[model samples]
Target: MSIRGYLQILRPVNALVAGIAVLLGVLVAGGEVTPVLFLLVVAVFCITGAGNAVNDYYDREIDAINRPDRPIPSGAVSIRGAAVYSAVLFLFGIACAAFVHPFCFGIACLNSLLLVAYAARLKGVPLAGNIVVSYLAGSIFLFGGAAAGTDGLLLNLPLAGIVFLPMTAREILKDAEDIEGDREGGARTLPMVTGVLTSCRIAAVLAAGAVLLSLLPVVPWWGWWYLGMIALADLVILYAVASAFRCTTSACVRESGATSMLKTGMFAALGVLLFWALIG
Candidate 1:
């Protein structure tokens, strides 16, 4: 197996983004740069990479059609190798989390199991899959907060909500985008069962909810700076919602475009959180 193939299977960019999210979570909780915080970052990175690798393993057949360039489909990595790699990463992540705190270790174990279940079974189970994925994404903040203690986890709840809603919307949009491949793979996603128009409408509603949630007051120190920065993120999400709502037909469902905007808006929102955390 090529080293690059293993890295590609890990989807390092996405893994890095998850690692950064953990750091943001810690910062938002007013956590100092302790060694435990660093361990959380590493733990999150490995777990996220494991999730991606396992997903690629389970979706190898689908990738053959939807994404032939993926490591498994492109003959860069064997299916067994991918599975073994994921297992190793998951173990490493759990080990690192064990050093941080009991809460974090628990989260790591739960998330690791959820990730495997998501790829192996839930991914084909309509809205169930979307909810699981959303929870997993949102829990990254909770995981980091746990490193700071219980109060930090409580403080990060709103932040988790902010991430969860839009992520759910994006997951639905992605299902819509991959309807054909998903159908061929015998997966019953929301768009497949409910149709693209209905799915897009649901996604629009979820995005709108995220926009509303973004307006809630955060920590005292964030104050107006958070509001101003979050407003820009809200506008971007609003645009995505509008785009979703405009999809009157299956042919009109610009799923990729809408999802891309939502992702950009999420990154912007994360940036706002990071800025406030640093200054506060």
Candidate 2:
């Protein structure tokens, strides 16, 4: 494989973004930013990369059907080789975490196990799989606290939960977009197990829940700016979800757009979160 192709296999951008998010949590939570936390960042990046690799490998056939240009099924990396590569990365990541703190390492171990399980089987269990992926996405924040040798600020966790809740909902909505490929592949995703309409309604409700929960931190502890930004974000999400609710013709299209918009909103809100976490 060419260097570029192999680089794609590593999914460095995805890993780097995730690792930085981890660091951001520690910083925002007012945890000690030490050398060990730095090391933990690298370790988590490697593990995230490994998980991506394994996911790509496992998804070869399905990806070939859905994403023909992907590295593995596209013939850039051998499937067996990718599996071994992923295993090595995961082991190294866990080993580094183990060295930092046993508590953190235990979390790392479980996280790795969950990733493998999700990629292997849980991904086929409808809402269960979505919950697994969504909760794990949120746990990345918690892992940051663990790596920093603390449980993070309580106030910060509430915000984290708010962020995670919608992200989880969006994940399910994204799954709704993939109903055809998943069903064709015999995978049991939410849209496949239940009808697309049901899955979508559930996604909308979860998204609404996220909006309500996000306001919890804004009451007295947070400043006006915090509440305003969160409200703005929530309003955007609600509008998009409302559109989904209104669409009766092609629920899939609305669901797909809504999920994509949710992701965009999530990324955009990082600045608002940083502002509140740092200044307020």
Candidate 3:
């Protein structure tokens, strides 16, 4: 159970999903694939692992209070061990990114910095923490394109803003549900500022906007596959958002998180095929 829990801490599933989006973005941006993808994946893994370790470090107090079963506070892994691991991962991530491209290396630095900030300080701020995390979560895709020497092929600023901003809003909503754990741990997020219901409504609005934004890249530059995937993703996201709104309960929101994550994963999974086809 400890091994499994620690593996969950690694969040490999999320890393793989994020990697998919990155590869798709790279392909769409017309980057010639030559082992660059592998390097990018390694970089993602390291940075994400480091981020996990740092979060554990900063959240030690919170975990003791709210998540007593976690690795560090629960005696599964020593805090020193976790810190050393995090430092190693971060170093490895930087090295991997250095082999990719300067742009990607810079992005890795930013990601690590933001993760540390979120873990140490930003988490208590209203909405700020959620935005930081959401951007970090979605940035893997953007970095993939950047690594391939594509400035903004598949994931332009507009595209990223559209997808990530809404995701940030949703993250805030999640904080609201985790208020018990968060409040106990002394984190003051958006829901703490406004209210749970208000946060939920804000998430709904963002979800709707994300669905709409998925359609923007479907013009003459793109084709049927992109269109189809966008439609499919929009349908799935809209349904999940609607359910979250209608249900309006903590249990319901938790379920919606799973549903939304699944749908988001689907969207990322299908991106490669769509963008590969759209490459001019």
Candidate 4:
């Protein structure tokens, strides 16, 4: 594959977001910023990139209709080549995690399998696919906490929920946005079954749930700084929810204003968590 193909397969921006999630996990669990944390971040990044590539491999046909510019659909990378690259990345990620901690290794292995399963089959199975994606998003925090070799999973719980709920919402919105290609490809997504308006309402509900959850006690050592930061994050989430409600057509959802806002909120939340952990 060409270097451009490799970069496209990696989805560098998403991988970086996932790597930062691992770092936040360490900070939340009060783990020392050792070289081990760096290893964990790299492992997560590789694994996430692998997942993205494999997903593209499986969704090549659908992408041809929905996203012709994607690596596989555009012929930038062959399906077999992408599959091999994904396998190599997965193994390398597992190896890195194994060197970090036994718990991290176990999570990495399971996550890799789940990623493959999602790409191969679950992605077309309606709500099941969306939930699986949500779980994968939440697992980043758990994987990070595991790398710390501590029992402070509680520290990671709220962060996991924060990531999970909004991701679930986004997954549904994406399904709604891709309804045309998905239907053409015989996908049984929620929007296909219940229609776009209903799916949008469901997504909005999930977004609201995330915002409400954010208001409760999350970080044990958090102070006013954390509260203020999180409140601002909540507003961003709320705005996303509002935008979801405003989306009157599939085309609007495809524009993904709400999804972008959610991503921004997630990154802002992580920054706040890191700062709070340091100052506290």
Off by over 4 Å in 2: 148-156, 218-221, 246-251, 254-256
- Global lDDT of each candidate: 0.87, 0.71, 0.71, 0.84
| Tens digit per residue, CA lDDT, model 1, 193-218 | 88888888899889888888888765
Q: Which one wins by lDDT: 2 or 3?
A: 2
> Against the true structure, what is every candidate's RMSD?
1.6, 2.7, 3.1, 1.6
Candidate 2 lDDT over 127-234, as tens digits, reads 777777776667666677665455563434665676677777787776766666676677878666666677667778888888887776542346566778878878
**Residue 257, candidate 4: alpha-carbon lDDT:** 81
- Rank ordering of all candidates by lDDT, starting from the highest: 1, 4, 2, 3
- Backbone clash pairs for candidate 4 read none
Residue-pair clashes per prediction, in order, are: 0, 0, 0, 0
| Candidate 2 lowest-lDDT run of ten | 246-255
Off by over 4 Å in 1: 248-251, 254-256
TM-score of each: 0.95, 0.88, 0.85, 0.94
User: Model 3 — which ten-residue stretch has the worst lDDT?
Assistant: 269-278
